[model samples]
Target chain A: MVQPGSIVGGLLGFLGKLGASVYFLGEILRQSGIGIARPRLVVEQIHNAGVLSLVIIMTSGLFVGMVLGLQGVDALSRLRQEDILGASVALVLLKELGPVVTALLFAGRAGTALASEIGLMRATDQLSAMEVMAIDPVRRIVAPRFLGGAISLPLLTGVFNVVGILGAWFIGVYVLGVDNGAFWSQMQEYVDPEDIWEGIFKSAAFGVAASLIAVFEGYNAVPTAEGVGLATTRTVVTTSIVILMLDYVITAALL
Target chain B: MDNLIEIKNLHFKRADRPIFAGLDLDIPRGKVTAIMGPSGTGKTTLLRMITGQLRAGQGSVRIADGDGMTDIGTLDRDAIYRLRRRMGMLFQNSALLTDLDVFENVAFPLREITDLPDRLIRPIVLMKLEAVGLRGAAGLMPSELSGGMGRRVAMARALVMDPELLLYDEPFSGLDPISLGVILRLIRETNDVLGLTSIVVSHDVEEIARLADYCYVIAEGRAIAHGPPAELARSESDLVRQFMAGAADGPVPFHYPAGDFARDLAGD
Candidate 1:
């Protein structure tokens, strides 16, 4: 029932609104006095957004590491490059795969949730209520989530990196009969501090992009059930696209 | 009394569609002014414009006087926030935060705006809740509340800041007679107790007639009638007469489809 042109127009409109909101947020933070600078909101958001995504990330990490290990062993065994297995796994986890995959999962799960919650609030006028009471919804609501996702993504990516490496090591050393010490030493030789930094930087950017897209979609949601659904769909699609695009750009620049 | 809120030559548009143009009105301090209008007549837009939620294209909305007065049009977003701190609004559908229980909902603005300790916030939230006769409902989520109860919780939350200006958008809608009486009494009592300036937007003529010290009839994006309710009740205008009498016929058509009416007439 909806046209593709309108959908594209809506997306552009959302981006424009988000740009305006970012400007608005900067103004709000500039003018807010010391009294309302409660760090508890951000702390709460970090806990909510970060800690809540842990189980999913951990589960996905373990399986992804196992699958990558299986595929790496299969391909490397054929090429007689099993000696470089650990370095390959570590490089993939730290450079291109771990942060990107985790971000995609987060965009699907937490990003969708954030959009729906915010969209519902917008639809119901809770944001307007906050404005009327002199409370900045951005400060109280969006900033917390934005900063939370920004902080949490890197932390979660680190968790994913660590867990994924361990899972891959377990698969390589035990399941595939690869030497544990040799595998670890290869990883130590090839993995650099820059690799970790690159992954973390990517995660942080992805987090911000995803959370911002979600919040923007939610804030601009039309006041209807159908609007909420559309906002949720847009949030997921936009966040996923942005995450993938940013991953490519960041990787291209950093590598 | 000096005007609490003054709008001068207000103009607004959305996506190039004209919402209002050259609108002017004055709301006296410490009085309840009811704005009545048909749907799409810019009643809610006027409220939003005055509250700084929507900026006017070419007019000024000034609230209070001297130190308290703030120009709604000129203030930046942050300044508008500070201005909003001195005001409260009860939305048509209550708009209570679903994630929060009644107590937390009432305490939200305080928690966000002030560094008040939990001990202090507790009593303030309870006091506001008590004022709304929802003291017992403080632990309930918004999902558990009836329409009237949710409105009261929203009122409680709105009053937690003890705002100087109170705005109500369709406060009487979806309320039972008893609940309506209670809400009306509470609005009047709270305004008097706080010495608050109140602005109500409502289509309920009887309620507006009973409650408003001054009533403004907005039709077709302009103020068609403005005065005391008694004065407007005596007006000879067809719009006012039809609106006040709740008639289906007058200057306003129901806007039902012609084909549907034609089919009904054929059946008859």
Candidate 2:
């Protein structure tokens, strides 16, 4: 049984270690020339990370848009701001809601998988094997994943935005008998390309943060099943925190 | 005779706890030097330090000058990587990449480090796989392999680079007798055929006695005895005698205390 102060100290130590790990990863990337070499691998990783994540992202997007449309239409109908329905949906999906929700979904699905896969590699000494063969594990393993996430996030966010808006449009205009032209016209007037850009930027940043956290946790995992589980849990939690923080910052800047 | 690897007064510490202190050794070219020790005597650490995986605190490790006899410790990250290409290591576990099949696992280093075409790469990978008797397992994933087969696949991967130096960390740990014989014979044949310098860290005394041209007995963070296996067999040192004979009642006692024994007996 650890003392309460010791627990707090342990938490602080964990945070410090995480910070150092991120710094070390940055150094590895710089040293390995990951930004330049292995472009094809990065593309492959992006396809895997972003495209493979689409089914879940789309599913979540559709349901979320439906729920928001139902609730917002119900509340706004009483206030007689029903003409602002498309603008409200567009605002929520473009600036704040879509990226955050997609990131949370990604953290649960792809993020955990990345952590477990890398953790297993570490546990099995495959990473050490790469070092002995003179192959840079960072370039071969980590860089691809990082690049994949960076590329995938914006693309996935775009998918979320399109799908989400369509779902909201169906609910607002077709299902609820709201004026279709007014909703789209207001959306076209109010929602700039910069709004979409902000959401994408936030999503991309979240993707990079999530990938970094997952890979770091996996690479540093202790040699046990429990350690892999712990790394997965930490990856999800840390990615969620980062996504929420970035969501606020991006929203404030854009709005 | 040229020494393939030379270590002068190597020292290492982990978190300020001394793992090795002032260790010196030489691995001659074209020979197998077996490191025999009980567990936790820095055998693995010594191997890791030699291969540049871990850095030594206070010593110089130099490889032969055939391709620039660089001091391993002074090399930059790129140089270190290039230097590592000249050495091969078979880890305690097979350590085959789970994401790759057998052929791809063997071909991984070549693919990453060289621009060899598929026509060139396929034959080379197949040849290596055939050497380890795993050519048929080329398409199989690592999960499909038995323990011995996994080790063989790892051996193929290690040897694909045609390295000058080979390090085997407890290669005989989890093998059946037939598999052990095959592995031992392969190691001997591979070293002789390629003239590869080899260092095998093992606790398998019988295997070391049979195979090692020269042997070092490590205990208590030091090489307690070092010589030909025959010479070490005749030593009067109690530590060497106890280790060679596999006695539990020697200078190295069991780690458990009397209180633990009493507790075990009382079922507490």
Candidate 3:
């Protein structure tokens, strides 16, 4: 009933895609039940989606933390509160930058890989061949990749959080000559367990969201070269937007 | 039950164009059948319908399983998967999993569907690879394979499940003459030795004549001719004759439909 080239038509098309994506997520979760039983499949995918992405995540995390250290010192030194650099950097990273930035990096790094791999499989008739063999591709091919991404993102975020803190500590305590004990002590004191828990929860949510979008875009990608390219592009853009939006909603709700 | 698959009044359309309109055909058990047609004539589409990858828009595509004839359109997703286990298809592109090496590719269905241990799987995989004359290439990845070797490996994989029915989509499209002969022999030998019914969709008129027991030439969504390969070659219908002879001008014109050449040349 929706008319083409009209405002309502565009809205309906978007809603239709959103609805299909949600349904695709449900299918992935359902197939994950089967995928989990075969741990090797999921584990192999974890290596592909998670292990392969470590270099970028860690590298970006270190740089982001160093930047935060320099910026935090510059801004707080004006108020003569530079001694509290440890507390502020730790708070910002653990509460916000850690999960959000890691997810953004993960999308660019791992998400695109998942999309392109699955998209190419479709383009090459590999998925259809699986179907012909009575193998459910959602179970065999997609769910493992989705679960791998979901599991790996939080773990990767954890790595980012640790490496980021180390980078900040190196900059603030060693280079800036802040009292080392004060840096460690204040970070431990002011950074509550809730802050760590919030970061963990946000990261886990982002991981699931980002992974779902990636595999969803891939499994449903049109079977062509241009189609696969576009699907890969959509995965990065959609995952980034969704992660940022979820960050706001999750932080607001948790706060 | 003599016929393994029966399609009646099979109507399918892609957007506004009809792909199969009231197409009826029967594939006999324990024989090689060829669905031959020129490009874009829905020969592959018909194969998809029979395999339940696609459904008939109106009419029925029925496959005779143990219970009885089951209409593909009536089956749900799980039902279709269950049905597909008894069917094997060799895709036009070979469709080998790029991640797996040649050995693993042939062993893929067994590993996915059966719990056979490596000890048993090893010999079985090697045997299928041996059948395809590629046992030496088992460890090589798909990227390393030539077009012919890839097709052979795929054929081995298609036969791995010991399926009752096998479908091949354009199996001889791109191959050297020697490779083509190897595949041609493999199709005939496997069909007979395994007691498997095969439906090969291809346009290789000479090749189909040498291999197929029966042939169906489809056009404009219907079977325009059906009989033995020799009988089809002798058909009087202009369309069938054009296809059989590979004629450039006949019912199917050499020149695409256009305005008057003289008028167009003068920029009318």
TM-score of 3: 0.96
lDDT tens digits, residue span B14-101, model 1: 8888877777889999999999988778888888987888888888888874677678788887788888888899999999999989
Query: What DockQ does candidate 3 score?
Result: 0.85
Tell me the lDDT of model 2 at A30. Answer: 73
Query: Against the true two-chain complex, what DockQ does each candidate achieve?
Result: 0.76, 0.89, 0.85
lDDT of each: 0.85, 0.85, 0.91
| TM-score per candidate, chains pooled | 0.90, 0.94, 0.96
Candidate that beats the other on lDDT, 1 or 3, i.e. the better one: 3
Model 2 / residue A115 / CA error / Å: 1.3
Q: Which portions of model 1 miss their true places by more than 4 Å?
A: A1-36, B67-70, B256-268
Best by TM-score: 3
Top candidate, metric lDDT: 3
Predicted structure 1: lDDT? 0.85
- Model 1 C-alpha lDDT per residue in residues A1-255, reported as the tens digit of each score: 899999999999878876886775574345434224666777787787789999999988888888878888889999987767899998899888888898888888888888888889988999888888877777677777777777788888889988888888788889998888888888889888988888878888887777777777787789789999999999888778878888889888876
Strongest candidate by DockQ: 2
